[model samples]
Target: MTNDMKLNKLLLTLSVGALSFIQACRSPESDEKLKSTIQAALETTPGIEVNVEEGNVTLDGQIGSDSLKQNIEDKTKMAGGENIKSIHNNIVVNLPEPEDAREKYHEIIGGAVDSTLTRDVNLVLADFPTITAQVKEGIIVATGNLEKSKIDTLKKRLEHIKPKGIDMKGVISR
Candidate 1:
């Protein structure tokens, strides 16, 4: 080949390699696009603030009921799809005060919901032998060593219960 032809061929090969390297290094999902998807899911629900980073999402706002809060979270998760890594549902449920708030609280303590939560939490823990969790008063405290790959899946399953909060601070991930 002529010198000019060899130079052109080398440039084309370098260009192809560069493109391949970039494509291989790119993440499956972009944070901005994922945020838009989640935002669309929560658009009908007011007072919601959605933030996404590296596929992790945080939903913060005020809503009327526990069920609504869970519903909003579910919608956003579905819309976020397989790209989601983790989610924090910080939306608060503003339930109207009962005639006697203390009495209402007592009545619900150890109620069927709590029983179910206890049972469900145990079941979840069983699935993750390396991790242990405790449920009390609508909150979950988890502690143990977990594989890094399982973190998102475990978090999603735990969030499905719509707990007041989850404290995984004691858990270590590899």
Candidate 2:
């Protein structure tokens, strides 16, 4: 081939190569596509929040279980593919609240203890109509006029009901 023709062909090839390389470089559009893909993948998952910027994906908010977290991460990777630069998982695993003794008593003892406690409390406070009693935090709090003898009797009866203790601070006539 002629020297001038060869030179022109080489220049054209180099120009095309440079243009392709520039086009292949990361852009805002690519990042947006990755974000869209991740959002679409996690659309059904509740409480999971996602943020994407410059091909970096950030996952945040709460999840119920560790298995769920793993599943979500795997799905995110599948959706994001090689275009994802990095993944920042800041998701928190939330546990359920523990059951309290009072709640268990209510569930198990139910009307049996409730009725007996009411009857016994009424018997103890029959003379003092102004006095009121309630069960709070596993303790029986009696308010208004009270006597030590009545308190002892109430405590003896309440032992059957399995209370933690009797709160006598509300009783004025101790």
Q: Point to the candidate with the largest lDDT.
A: 1
Give the per-residue lDDT of model 1 (tens digit) for 9-63. Answer: 9999999999988654535458788888888877777779988776778999976
Model 2 TM-score (2 dp): 0.42
Please report how far candidate 1 places residue 67 from its true position, in Å: 0.2
TM-score of each prediction: 0.40, 0.42
Per-residue lDDT value at 173 in model 2: 63
* Tens-digit lDDT track of model 2 for 38-102: 88888766668888877788999875445556667878999999888789988896632222323
lDDT of 2: 0.67
lDDT of 1: 0.74
Candidate 1's TM-score: 0.40
**Clashing pairs in model 1?**
none
lDDT of 2 at 172: 71
